[model samples]
Target: MTAVGKQIREAILATGPISIAQYMQLSLTSPVGGYYTHGQVFGRTGDFVTSPEISQMFGEIMAIWYILHWEMMGRPTKTRFVELGPGRGTLMDDMLRAAKRFPQFFATIQGVEFVERSPELRRVQMEKLGCPKESMESVKDKNEPDTPGSAVSERYGGISVRWHTQLEEVSVESDCVPMVMAHEFFDALPIYKFEKGTSGWSEVLVDVDDSTTTPAPPQTTSARLAGSPHSSASDNSSECHFKFVRSRSVTSNAAVILRDPRFDSRFDKGDHVEVSAESARVMAVLADWVSQNNGLALIVDYGQDWTQGDTFRGIRKHKFANPLSQPGSMDLTADVDFSYLRLAAQGKAKCFGPVEQGKFLLDMGIQARLKQLLQATTDKKVQQDLVDCYKRLTDPNSMGRIYKVLAVLPNGAQGMPIPFAPPSKEELNRPKVEKIVRK
Candidate 1:
């Protein structure tokens, strides 16, 4: 067992059971043995790979998208290019490099801020982007940036990057605009899983199973049966095991009552629903910033417009693992509910397509960019690699259909942003090509 696993087991043994949210938070952020707090977790060598790591084109396309929208927003003299969960700073680096074509947009960029909390990942980000000039500053709240002029110089470019632990720490002048990007970010935020009971929905908790000599159910209901679905549950050899059990109330203060009308009395006993208040809270803050200061936030992730069932899973060395089996040795993620995010933006900011990532990238002209790269390259291996990356990004069976993109704009904005504009009346009336599901 991992060190963090022992810590978690001890905590659960002392306290009755811990909510899934608490388990995830502890597993991912525990200062001493948390997964992210200890080591690198991106790219091929890590547990899983992200879009930005798959190809530089991903971030370059986003830069172009930003430029187009910035122009529509009047291209303010000072714009903050902010990114949340910037992994190794690859996306920001590519974005900065591509923004050079539009000198004004690139020059007008005030500061590139990253919202990251992991000290280990922060060092990795600084290595790629640029090391901080001084020790990182601590902020009291989200409204304040640590200190003015606290920036990290980019290794390749002259741009300076600032780091913040929370969205509230990212700040700008009253009149300045902030264009924010969060790629594959929302899924990582801790989520609460609730299962409908005979009484009502209750939060899921992790607990030690002393029911029998056999291994206990990990997550899926099938694991509770005589023939458990989990491979480990078949052993029946362990004296003690860890399993999921429902609890009436959450021990962690992070749990909140989810209020979505669609799910009202929708499930029979034993149905599951996942909620991410952290994701919603972050969106609320970002939406408020855009509505007040005028800018956009692009959120890209692999999720459905609305989600049900158990989407929470874990990854260790790129393969699926039981989420409850190991702590701080892998990544835990759940499918993002884009619809919930759009709901959070209501009244605060105007929301756009929670479109399929494939469709969004295509609409943003990824094919044109791909063709340019193919023509410029001569090595067959390089060409093949590019083709594979493109397919992974756009293939429906892959991220193309599974991943989604959401854009948040200032409320009452005049025109639509690129890749998210509504179709013409005639096109809308025709048989729709189901590339993306919009809310």
Candidate 2:
């Protein structure tokens, strides 16, 4: 019963219940059966492997944390090395091969956008960035031109490269700086699941049951009414049929049953819940284009550190499944709240380390880039598969304690490089059940 669950049960029998972020944006960008628009989900033959496909010492320690945040932003003659969702461009080819050891930060980098919206993964990021269409027209020659019937850009390329489809059409130039980056790009943004029953919250829909239309045999139901009287009906699945309405004055009236009746009535289980309000309004338009241009951002994903509950998930070949078994064919994600990304960088940016991508790649040196790739590969089983990909990227049992690492800057900025050290206030006020009892 998959072909994205028979096209989401014929779009809920031709329109009726759809919004778990519009069924995760048509199940991951629908340009025709979207599970990332048709396959090759990303290396080791797909399904999971990221962290720049797990090595090249994780993009050479994220190009030494973007050359210490481009020398803490002061070395900017022109900067703008963006990257939101640039997959298959292997972390921008290991961040331009670790920014060719600062050939003046690759000649002040000046251009390399790429927000991306799949023209077959933008021709696999223009054949893995052999770059050139005059360096992708030097980011459309820094925007605004075109007056008399514009085609803009007359010339440039002191190193450019563009391609955006969002991040508000990315074409910045004025006071440059804007250095952004994303790795697991905010956990594929799209989540909304609530479950706290009784009669106060019940939003988890995905309806289509007038007898399953002309295609039968996928029937499943549950919604046994009868509320109040200290309500309670926690487990009697058909997915979820909550009824926990207890309020002996009020300390537990919870009622939010949404477990997928497609996307039950959009919202109402304590409202304020959203997944990708276009990824927090494209991270508040990249923190107001790096706080009115003087930039810095760095994401890296797999999230948490916000509060509330539910962190929707799913994946396929590499395991953990049943995100409603096959709708748009698997791979839906969530958990990058980082406190609504620091309230979408509203204080005009200055967030740091949502930390724990194995302590920010072992504080950005990944064990000295894994001993310089085991002293340039001598091969004892290729140094035990690069010491088992650095213990699956710094093992706290894998993907280093559920992956995370955020950064934002643009407030009293100064030549970057301070990798880890900002996560306190008792480590961001502890308790989400101590991060699920420390996972």
lDDT by residue for model 1 (1-439), tens = 6677788889999977887878899888886588887657776677677788888889999999989887887778888888898877889878887987788887888778888887566667766666554644444456445332234565434556677788887778776788899987888898888876675567787897656544442443211111111223222222334688877643334234555555554555666778888888988998998888777889998877765557787665555566776578777888888878888888999988778888888988999999999999999999998988887787776678878888898897876778776756874575421122213
lDDT of each: 0.74, 0.60
lDDT of 2 by residue, 1-439 (tens): 5455567667866875554656677778876577886637876566666767767888878777877766755577677677888877777767776787677876777667777766566556655666433323222333323111111122223345667767777867776776788777767876554443445344455554434223211221111001111112221112211111212322211222223332334333343333355576677777777777767778877656654344554555454444554556656776676767777676776777677787788877788778877999887998998888787777865677667777887766654446757456986677543222212
Where is model 1 more than 4 Å wrong at Cα?
A: 132-150, 154-157, 210-241, 248-256, 259-261, 423-439
Q: Output the number of the TM-score-best candidate.
A: 1
- Model 1 poorest 10 in a row by lDDT: 221-230
